[model samples]
Target: MSSPTHSANTGRIILHIGTGSFHRAHQAWYLHRLRESGNEHALDWSIAAGNIRSDMNPTHEALAAQNGMYTLETVTPDGVRAYEHIRSIQHVLPWSPDHAPLIECGASRTCRIISFTVTESGYYLDSRDRLDVSHPDIAADLDGARTTIYGVLAAILDARRRADGGPVTLQCCDNLRHNGEKFRAGFAEFLERRNLAELKRWVDEHTTTPSAMVDRITPRPTPDIRPHVLAATGFDDRCPVMGESFAQWVIEDDFIAGRPAWESAGAELVDSVLPYEEAKIRILNATHSCIAWAGTLAGFEYIHEGTGDAEIARFAGDYITQDVIPSLLPSPVDLPRYRDVVLERFGNPDIRDTNERVAADGFTKLSGFIVPTLRDCFARGASPSATALLPALFLAFLARWADGTLRIPYRDSLLDHQEIRAMLASEDPVAVFCADRRVWGELASDSRLVEAVRTASHSVNLWLAARHGVHNRK
Candidate 1:
């Protein structure tokens, strides 16, 4: 088969600025499938890659060498299906301090849509969901007259405004609830603070940040899978992606300039994505967090191994179906069906998602993904069960780092293990860990929840004592 090319004949451009694996496997692959399914008009959508991080140099090289194409392997229980011509990307912007090209793309008349999977922390928002102007990088971006927010996005929006562009659809593919709204709010907050009232007004009039719910178990590439991906595609792409067969993108149709009939591209465009967002975040994401920390502490490496352990699996399932779901108001979701899907996805052996990877960043993951669900349960006066244990396990995980029992595998990142170690060594580790007003926010003082977490930590300590004879150092 010939390599796929963007159907430029239709005169539409789809700019994906992030080069992360999730972007490739989920959004880019979806666009590829849309083109293959005879959506020729949609095929005109082209993706120009952009990245700000210094580490993306090798990724840019590998992707450019392959003509901006790579293989997407979807592993299922039935078998593995691989697509060779997964070509939604048209060009990649070289990682440079000057982001003029990115800005121009966003402002282009032909570019009606912009999409992103820049993870949870990318927005640069403080705990209160406001833009964190205090962040050194954010301050630098602002001071330098950088066009992009967070370096890349602000430039794109700036270019769009200069081009006399109409409202451009801003689709956020992150895991946060009302994610699009959050992005817009953050941008607006920055504008207001910087006294760019005029630009803020322009944005308010022109852009639409549509809330979206996206899910897929895209695991970070491992050493073992890298060779397989290379052999399969005959290219040595260092950042190959691996994911489960399942994928979903539920978005609200609140675009400004226009949008790809993303619906035509297998994305569900809804009137309101709030319910879907809540359902996925509370059930899928929250349960994933539970399994991650719980499974890791139990010595299970992969999600499949974690699920195979009856006690851990039961704890996960019960926490979601029983405790988490019931706490929601006027629950329109089918919890049982959701649980089944989560189970099958977690058991996808080919994905090889590590518990340790998911278990990292428990501070952010717990507060954003899991704690809200716990809060809802408490608000509804529900009993604490396995759901209550989520935070407990997270606290224990943090506590373990103090004793050097757990080590963060990722290279130098924001999550300071030394700070975590110091916090754990304090007179009251749980209190100290929870006292980081930035992290716990107001939840730091929730007496009932705090007590439950303390109890759970005690249980973990006892379990450790019993297993490894008191001074267990595993």
Candidate 2:
């Protein structure tokens, strides 16, 4: 580990577990901006990033070839594109079978904080907020050595506890609402599963998990991004990332040891991250999903194209104005302005965010993003008319999957192919689909959701067919 006096390597360290493009464009970008602003303390906060999945080996090769430096390409709605070099990550170990390097980094005295971005499903959490030990990875990680979040975290914290590394914070940059609290519970429950009583005590006394809301529409980095960066910057950057011009991060100001003054780089350091998170989740995220699914049904390729379409645009607008905004009435957010900004960001043509990319994990998005609005509608005794359009759109999208009419592939980790087949074969497929608790929660049995979805699904099918018929005539 580098000491505080080490000029080249800096002082305080942040161990990030995933080297995904979103992290490159979002969290690490913030720290890089802090350093660029000539903040002396920012020099101490170099990131050491690695990966747990083999899928990230290509990303590892690309980034390591560049010494963790990458170009960020930003585009706005008016077709303006900009590029910048980002360099907050100073060291990376990549993915390896040996855990020595990661554990060593996590246990070091200078490593004040650790963060990760494995997306929502990567947490391996069930609806009840328990670790699904039955999962193959969790099962393998239980009594053996493996690299799931819990396994790696346990190994690292065990070393930290033994070394008396003082206090540290765990930051989950994933999009789960109440992410910090949820991940804290997950780690504790995972510790209980492992029976690491002593280490659990150490974590309870020393570690803090702070929630954050991060927004940046980072598309999956493909080979094209590399050449785009090269052409724009006169550098052959291998792992360049691209996003919309808009970015926002709001974090809870609860750190155990200490943290970088991230606000120096435009991040919001607030007493609570709830208002920001709720606004982003219900408005931005839910609307993002609505556009992805509805736009796919309308045969659009990219999210911007979908958000640009008149019908799809109205679908997203109605969702926010009619149902979601009402559910979140009298909140701290300036709803109207934020809504327009979200639309502008989404419709940025220069950013080619694929509907297939945004539309992945529909099952998870239904529960995590859209279902809360539905629940709120029922709670307030309001008709979920607009909210019901979301699920109706999703089910109609799934029909494209079942009928082999999908123009692009879609995948959801939690989706069951057999069950989908069964639903397609049922007398009332909409009713069968509505009954799945994973998608609808306890209200899966509610009759209003069933009828609303059924009517909406029929209307969606007709709309899609009409669009296709007109196209065929043309």
Candidate 3:
């Protein structure tokens, strides 16, 4: 690990275990803003961030070379752009296969909050919220491998307990619905499965996982950003991050170990993050995926392209106004205005958020983002046609991928490659997909769900045909 440029202080540390673009653009940005404000509470907090995996080795190297400093380029929907030098991360731990440095930092009493941003599928949870013990990663983690979150956290917490390190909060900065709760459950189960009853008890008594809702349309950092940052900011930052100007973080105020005054930096420390998370997951995230899948089918590369199309926008708008808002009635959030704002953000051309980025992990999104609205609509005796279109679009997108016709390589962490191929070869592909319990949970057996998905799939095919000026399918 490289020493930070800024002098070390007596401030407590936030050991964040992901140095990806989203983490830099969102969480690290918030801390940067907080520190820049010169608030006394904020000054007492700092971030020591690193990745659990070596996939981000280049980014880590760049950050370490620059003393954990980077430039953040933020653009608005109207093409307005701004750059800021972010210096919130004071430590950039080098990547290691054994995760020794990360575990050491996380085990320290100075590390009051151990936050992480593994993607949604990284949790390894099944439809019923149980840890997917059958997954090879989860299985390996159970037997002392430190690859997955469960594996890493288990090692960290056990070390912390052994060191007599004080209590710490385990904050999950992911898109999973009820993310903190789900993570805590999985972590507890992981310990129990390992038969580490002492460590499990200590964690249960000491740690607090507050659910949070984080939103920012941060694309994977493109090469164009580096030159722009250099020209604008006079800094040749190698690891510049970019995102839309719109960002929101609503966290449940349940931190056990003291936390920073993030509210001063535009973060909402709410009593309950339920409404905020539901709105984000269902309205924004699900709609984002809808546009991505639809845009990809229409041969569009960017999310802005899909959101710009009238028919595609209508599909997304109707999903929000008709199904999502209805299900989330009595929410404190302004459903209509929020829906409009979300769509506008999606239409931001400068962000350059790709269809492939938003469309990855369709299996997880099917259950996490789309199915809740479907189930709610069914319970209320209302049609979920708009919501159903998301899965339908995904169905079309998946077909393209299976047939080797997709323009971009589809990456799904939870995708079963061989199973998908077999399903495509089967006589009734749509039926087989609709029946997948992993995506639909118990709703897979519901005839209404089957019909809605089937109808929506037909509509999607027709829409694709019209876009290409071809005849409709039988």
Full-model lDDT for every candidate: 0.72, 0.85, 0.90
Best by lDDT: 3
lDDT: worst 10-residue window of model 1: 1-10
Query: Which stretches in model 3 have alpha-carbon errors above 4 Å?
Result: 1-9, 398-433, 470-474
Instruction: For candidate 3, write residues 39-83 as lDDT tens digits.
Output: 977777888888878989988999999988999999999999999
Would you list the clashing residue pairs of candidate 1? 107-160, 147-154, 147-155, 148-154, 148-155, 149-154, 167-256, 167-257, 168-257
Off by over 4 Å in 2: 1-10, 53-58
The TM-score that candidate 1 achieves is 0.85
Q: Which candidate tops TM-score? A: 2
lDDT of 1 at 295: 72
* lDDT-based ranking: 3, 2, 1
Model 3: lDDT equals 0.90
Question: Candidate 2's residue-wise lDDT over 92-150, tens digit each?
Answer: 76577866768888898988898999988788888677888888888878886666888
Residue-level lDDT for 36 in candidate 3: 91
How do these models rank on TM-score, best leading? 2, 3, 1
TM-score of candidate 3 against the unseen true structure = 0.90
Question: What tens digits encode model 1's per-residue C-alpha lDDT throughout 1-474?
Answer: 112254332367766767887888888888777877787576667777766665666877778777678766667744575634577787666666676656666677777787777787778877678887877767876775553444466667666787786677777888777898899888777777666667778877887888988877777766755677677777665557776778888888887766666787678888988877877877787777778777777767787787776767887888877777676656556777878888777877777778877777677767777777777777778766667678777777666656667644532144676776777778987777656655666677677766777886787667655645633654
